[model samples]
Target: MGSRIWKSIAFVAPLSGLALLMGFGEQIDEGACSGTLAFEKSRQLLEERPEVLDIAPGSFRWEGDCRFAMQGYADVATAGAPSRRTFELLVALEPRSHRWQEVSFSMGD
Candidate 1:
């Protein structure tokens, strides 16, 4: 009797938790991936690094919770030099509990 009751609770507990999750649609704090988010972040980066003239983020897709992929190019203007280039871009970004941060990136690859 004890074993049977324990088994029933084990099976029902997970199902109940899943039901609660599905009940509150999109209530979880886990962020979502979207082009707007990517574009805004890129714009913020440009502001943070004034040396960068522009970073036009073209497209974005979610890789997972660990990061979202951002595809874009950067136009850089140094103290006495300015250059603009477009190339294949791949970048990884991690979302913290409060904000997102760039982890790794590459261009022309």
Candidate 2:
């Protein structure tokens, strides 16, 4: 009797926790990769040129209570008008620390 009640409580506790997470999940901005950089505006070029291959090279800092700074570069490669190739990049970072993990990406568009 008591054991069955405890088992039901254990199952209900995790379900409620998952429901809370679904209700208050973080909002992730599309195509935004932040790292440990001083100025975030510097990387605005990443959104401008989506057709080119983007290479993001950067690192992130971790503190005990979720304060950090991140920065990096986004490289874009595109074909030129006269059989030439062009490379464009945006380097950016934020002043305040955000709770995020560093990831390595090798995807192209």
Candidate 3:
């Protein structure tokens, strides 16, 4: 039983890793400085359909250790009350891949 379980784990781990690599690799089409992409992802994570108002110039910058930063404002109706929301966004990306993942998104920060 123990050997069978180990064999299963050995087979599954490589497949799981391969799936992850392919998933990330396939997202290479997402371009750099894609506020729209970030906004769309934020909407999903924030669980609100926020209207991204403006992406401020110079608001986007680089951070240490595979991180990038950006900030903007949007009109979001959270808890059923519409209000202007400020966002401090951080992301990670591969330079050539152009695929990005959100690291953190804070509204009103």
**For every model in order, what is the number of clashing pairs?**
0, 8, 0
- Sorted by TM-score (best first), the order is 1, 3, 2
- Which residue segments of model 3 deviate by more than 4 Å? 1-58, 79-81, 94-98
Cα deviation in Å at residue 94, candidate 2? 26
Flag clash pairs in model 1.
Answer: none
Query: Which lDDT values do the candidates have, in the order given?
Result: 0.61, 0.44, 0.63
Better of 1 and 3 by TM-score: 1
Worst 10 residues of 3 by lDDT: 49-58
Alpha-carbon TM-score of each model against the true structure: 0.48, 0.29, 0.41
- Runs of candidate 1 with Cα error greater than 4 angstroms are 1-35, 79-81, 86-96, 107-109
Structure candidate 3, residue pairs in collision: none
Question: Over the stretch 6-98, how does candidate 1's per-residue lDDT look in tens digits?
Answer: 999999999999999899867754555554665566556545766567777676666665455666677777567667655333234454554
Q: On lDDT, who's better, 1 or 3?
A: 3
Worst 10 residues of 2 by lDDT: 82-91
lDDT of model 3, residue 106: 76
Cα lDDT tens digits, model 3, 1-109, are 9999999999999999999999876564434455565545544444432354333323666675556667666566556656676777777765777566778777772
Arrange candidates by lDDT, highest first: which order?
A: 3, 1, 2
